[model samples]
Target: MSTHPLIGWAVVHPWPAAGIAAATLAVLGAALWVTVRTARAIAWPPGPVLVAGTGALVCTGFGADTSWRFARDGLGMTDTTERAVLFAAGEIALFACAVMARANKTATSTDDAAGTTGVPGILVWAITGALVVPCYATSGIVGGTIRAFFGPVCAALLWHLAMGLEIRVARPEALSTGLPAVVGRELRERLLSRFGLANRDRTAEQITRDRAVDRAVHLAAVLELHPDGALSGYRRRRLAAAVARSGAGTNGEQRHRLLQQLAARRTSGQLATVPLASPWAGTPVPDEAYPRTPLGVTGAQLRTMDPLAAVRLVRAAHPEDSPAEVAALCTGYGVPVSETQVRIALRAGNQVAAAPAAPRPVLASEPEPVLGAGLRLDVESTALVHPEVQSRVPVLAAAGTRTRQVHARVPADDQTEPQHTAVPDAAHPVPAVPEYAVPHNEDIPESDRDVPDPDPLIEQARTEYGTAVPSYRALKTRYGIGQARAQRIRDALGGTT
Candidate 1:
C-alpha cells in the first residue's frame, strides 16, 4: 500500500503515504524517550509510571496513525505527513494528561509522609508533557496543515506555564516555618559562649602548652551569635576562658583575682554597677538603688578573724567565683585555704570560717643521727612534707649558723690574754671532730591531698536571690539541675516578696 521512505529518499523520489507515516512515528518515539530521560530519573519517579504512561501515549499515537491511513487510502486525502503529525500531537496531549493525573494521584497519597514534595512531581510531569507539544505541533504543521494544530498547541502551552504562577502564590505560606530554624541556630551558639561551656577533652598540660584552638572555636561561635552585641556575651566568654586558663597552673593568683572580681559583682553588686556613664542605659533601674555593700577593711579585719572567715567573706561576695579562683585568692593573701576548704566555706552559707585541716605528723620511721660537739650539721630538701625532717632539717640548718653572739665574750680589753693557753689542748687530742656530719633525709613520698570543695550554699543563695533570678532558674532547669537546690537557697528565705 505504501513505499518505505528510505528507499524513496535513496532514489531522490518523493516518499509515499506509508513511508511518511512510518518515518514520523519513528522520530516521535525517539524524542519522547529523550524527553523522559531528561525530565526525571528512573529511580526517582518510579520506572513503572513512566513505562505505563509512555505505553498509553504510544497507543494513542497509533490511533492518529490509523486515522491518517484512513484519510490517505480510504478517502483520497493525500497529505500523509500532515495526517501523521496531527495524530502524534493529539496522542502526546493525551499522554501529557495521563502523566499529570498519575503524578497528582501519587502526590496526594504521599503528601503527609514525603520528605520533599509537590514541586518535583509537578515539574516532572509538566516538563515531560510540555516538551512533546512543540514536536507534535511541528509535525502537524507539515505540508501546510497549520490551522488544525494551533488550538491544541496553545492549550498545552497554557498548562505548561501554570507551574511558575503557582509557586509565586504559595511562597508566603512557607516563610513562618522556615524563619525559626535560621534564627535559633544563630542564637544558641552565642548563648553557650556567654555561659562558657568548656570542652571536656582538653588536658591541663595541653592547655598550658596553649593549644587552645578548640576553646577558641567555641568563642568564635559565640561572637557570631551575638553579632548585634545587645548582651554582655562577649565579656562573659573572655572571663570564662581566662578563669579556665588560670585554674590549670601554678600562677593561679591572677586568675583568682579575676574570679574574685566576678564574685564581687555577684554578691556585693559592685562589679555589676553601671556608673553614670552606662552603655546599656535603656535598661530599667530601680527607683531607689541600694548603696554598695561594704566588704570591710582589708588586712586589719582579716588578722584576728577565724581562718575560714576570709573564705566565707569571699564566697559571700562572689558566689560564682570558681574553686580555683577562691583558693588562689586566699593563697595570694597568705590565707592558706585549700581548694576543698574554699568549696566547703562556700557551701556553709559563708558563715563558718573554713576550718583549717591539721597537718598530718610524720612518724619517726628512721633513726636519728648523733652529732659530735663543735660539729654542727644541717640538711635541707625542697620537699617539705616529711614530719620530722619538715621541722627538724630546717631548724638544724638555721641553728648550724650561730647569730652574732659575742664570740667568746670578745676579750674584754685585758681579760682575753689568758685564752692563748688553748693551743696546748690539740696535743691532748680533741678527738677528730667529724667534718659537718649532715645526714640527708631520704626523699619523702608525694602528698596526695585532695583539693578543697566549692561552697554550694552561696551558689544556691545567688540562684534564689540574684537579680535575674527567674532566668537563672530557667537555665538550671534546662540544664537538668532540679528546683530543690533553688528551694533550699538561704537567699530565698523571705521568698520573692
Candidate 2:
C-alpha cells in the first residue's frame, strides 16, 4: 500500500528541516542580541541592513512556500545538486545575517564602535519597503491593513534618519561672560552676511546663535572653530578659498605662510569681502557695501562645522524647524550636515550649562557709580557747579559733630563772583560772625573788589606770576593793594586769612 504523501516528507528531509531550524534559531539569537545592544541609541552599523532584510521577509513571509514551489516546479529543474547548493546558500545567508547582527551588538560596547550610517542605509530600507507589494501579497486583507498603517510610519522614520545623517555641529566652548564680550562685531557680521540686511535690530550675542547663519560663513572667517569645522550647507563661500588662493601646501611652512596672509587680510577686511563676493551678488542687498547679496555668513564656512554643532545652530535659530527641515536648509546653504548628533550635543551642552552663571544681566545697571563711605543725601542744591568741577569735588565724611568745609557753590546772581559760605557742622552751634561778614562787592570795580574776581586773578597768576596759587604779598605789593583786600584774595585762592 502507498504511504500518504505528507507522512514521510519530514522523515525523508530531516537534515534540511533541521538545518533550516538551526538557521532560524541563529537569526533569532542574533536579533535579540542586537536589540539589547542598540538600546543606547548609538549608531548601529548593521541596523539598516537588518531593517531592510526583515521588512522584505515580512512582505514575503506569507507566500514564501509558494515562491519556493514556483521556482522548483514552474521552472522544472529538480536536480539534487542544485537543491543542495540552494539550501547551502540560504543557510550561509542566514549565518551571515547573524554575524552582522552580532557585529552591531559587539561594536556598541567597545571603543572600536565603528558603527555608522549615511545615504546608503537609507536607500536599502527604502528599496526593501518598495519591494513589499510586488514580492508578495500580505495575508490578504491583513497585509493591506498593516501596510496602510506601516507605510507612512516607515517612510517618516526613514526621512527622520536621513535628516539625522545630514546635520553637522560647530560647538563653541562656553566662554566666561565675566570677560566683557564685544562679540556682534566681525564674527557676527561674518555670520550674517547672507541675511542681506542690516542686522542692527538684533544684539551681538543673539546673532552669534542664529541658525540661519550657522553655515553661511567659512571655518576661517570667524577665527573661532578649526579651519575644517565649517557647517555643510550655508549659502556662502568657504573660508578655505583664501587658503587655496594663497596656494598653501599641507606642509607646515606653507600653512604658516598662508595663515599669515589670512591674518593680514582679516585685519584689512579683505577676506570678509572676498568670500562674500560670489554668493551675495544676486541675492539681496542690505546696503551698497554688500550690493544685491544678503549680508550673510558664507555656506562654505558652515560646511566645515561638526555635524553636531550645526544642529544646535538650527535649534537655536528656529526652535520650531524640524530636523528634516534643518538638514535640508543646511544642504541648501551649501553646508550639508546631519541632525543625528544634535540631541547628543544638546544634552552635553545642557550638562555644561548648569555650571555657568547666566551672563546676560549686565544691562541691569549703568556704568556710573554709587555713594560710598560717606553720608548720603539726595538733596538738589542750588549750585552753579560745572560738571567738570562737580566731579573733582570730594564729598566729606558726615560725622555729625565734626566741622567740614565744602564749596557751598551759590549760583551767581548779578554778582560777578561765586560766593563762598562757611558751612558749620550739622551738630555744631553757630558762632556769631558780625565782624566776619564782609559787605557784598557786586558793583565794586576790579581794583576795589573785596575778593578780586577769581578768573582775572587766576589768569594773571597763570600768565604774569606763572602760578595757579599766588601769595597774598604778591597781590598786595604787585598791584599796591591794602592788607584786607590782599587777605581776602588770599582766602579765595585757598589760603588762610
TM-score (all chains, Cα) for each model: 0.16, 0.17
Worst 10 residues of 1 by lDDT: 443-452
lDDT of 1 by residue, 1-497 (tens): 78887776756754565687789899999999999997666444334434543444444444455445545654466776766555344445544564464355334432232112234434544544444444344354462133223333333333333322233233423321123335885687677556443454666664443333334434545555575675557656673675466543455654454445444443554545645666586867664222222475364455456767887776666678787787776665556678878767666334456789999998877653435533333444443343321222134555444432211222245444463423323323322222222221221112212212232543555565575444325533444332333322322333331
lDDT (C-alpha) at residue 18 in model 1: 64
Tens digits of lDDT, candidate 2, 259-371: 56446645775545655456646867554321111325445555566766655665566678766566666666655665555446456322223566667865675443334
Report the C-alpha displacement of residue 355, candidate 1, in angstroms.
30
lDDT of 2: 0.46
C-alpha-based local distance difference test score of model 1: 0.46
- Per-residue lDDT, model 2, residue 188, is 66
